[model samples]
Target: MRRDEVQVTLLYVFDELESDLGGTVSMREHSQVPESVTTIRDELRDSDFQVEALIAEGNPADMIVGVAADRDVDHIVVGGRQRSPAGKVIFGSVTQSVILDSDVPVTVVSVDAEGEGGDRP
Candidate 1:
């Protein structure tokens, strides 16, 4: 598809208290405007597509679904974390919720050090 025809919005979700609880958190504290979204926006800026970055609060799955409905997005892209078999069964998956509830198509992207599609190193 033509770049002009591509309209995309990147949503980055972060815990609200990550910054405040700083001092040895397992995950690095991310910005309100996430770096990944910024990188994507920068990469797409030269293209003809329209790109937006959204940072939201509350449960990740719920926020994603709500935004997808509110914005009427063609597709919702989310970064997924690989879960242990036990975790998957116990907590249920966030992506599953979005896939089930979204009015629009949802694209779940798994992230890793090597990039999308690669397993965690």
Candidate 2:
């Protein structure tokens, strides 16, 4: 990035399978931010990076791409675990979807599997 350029990390939380049964149930419960997401946001803030956090409920890939488009983001960075092509098909991959589907430039970083991959934000 150039010295004049600024990067704002957009933390988007997506609850894909949520459903409101004929408006009988409230979806406010899904608004809660995960601890891991908060941790990442805190870390980025501490590191002095511009950060914007948003909570949304929808297909993860679609939301990610939508945010990038809506915000006119210059670049997108996503973390992913190493996997074979067959593994990707079977397990499904949000990283793959965003990279292939997005019109903006995308950078993919490998995730560390030391403790848990769930902590990726």
Candidate 3:
């Protein structure tokens, strides 16, 4: 499907960290995110795609699924990285989690070790 035909929301999830006091640490006010998101939004806009950017703080997979549900998006696209079987078993994967949990159709685009985009193997 062409990007311009669909409304796009670019979401950036800031992973919540645990503080020394055992409280949730928020990066909602992070400075770099705005600029980064803007750069991405601008690029898509340049490409003639309708798009918007959103920032949410929490687990990446959960935030993605939650935002999709909240926004009533028709589809969800996520990036996946190659991992060894042991690594997959130990660390799990955000892409995997979202695929399993999301109600909408999901698409996974894999990135290679050099950060080049590719179809998932």
Candidate 4:
């Protein structure tokens, strides 16, 4: 989809309730988030997409899918981290769950180091 036609919603889910600030706050007022989200936001700001960042505390996968469904989003694009089988088993995979549960099309972006050599387009 063309960036100008599609709205980009940057979703950040805090697995721990305490990690999310309960009150409403603009993105500028919020200090806690993965650095990648900030970087992506900056990059998107340079592009044509209208970006909106959303932060909530809950099961990451559930929150993601719920938001997509609630917003009637056309598609969901999420970042995934490479992890060993053991790690996946221990922590579970949020991307995996989103892919499996989301009704809309889902694009998974690898956030692993291997894709970081000026990978973003």
TM-score leader? 4
Q: What stretches of model 3 exceed 4 Å from their correct place? A: 1-5, 19-21, 27-31, 34-39, 113-121
lDDT of residue 73 for candidate 3: 98
In order of listing, the candidates' clash counts read 0, 0, 0, 0
lDDT of 2 by residue, 25-118 (tens): 3344646555656777777777777787787766778888988898889899876778889998887888989989999889876666641245
Model 3, 1-121: lDDT tens digits are 7878978999988888778998888866653564545766788899889998887788989999999999999999876789998999988788999999999999997766654466434
Writing each residue's lDDT as its tens digit, candidate 1 over 1-121 gives: 8887787877765533334657433232444454566766887877667888776665668878888888888887767778889998987788888899888877778876433445434
- RMSD to the true structure for each prediction, in A, is 5.6, 4.8, 3.7, 5.3
What would the per-residue lDDT of candidate 4 be over residues 1-121, giving only the tens digit for each residue?
6878778889887764333557433443444677777778888978878999888877789999999999999999887888999999988999999999999999987777643423655
* lDDT of prediction 4: 0.81
Stretches of model 4 off by over 4 angstroms after superposition: 17-31, 113-118
Q: Which candidate is the best by lDDT?
A: 3
Q: TM-scores of all models? A: 0.69, 0.69, 0.76, 0.78
Ranking by lDDT: 3, 4, 2, 1
Question: Comparing candidate 2 with candidate 3, which one achieves the higher TM-score?
Answer: 3
Query: What Cα-based lDDT does every candidate model obtain?
Result: 0.71, 0.72, 0.83, 0.81
* Clashing residue pairs, backbone N/CA/C < 3 A, model 1: none
Give the clashing pairs for model 3. none
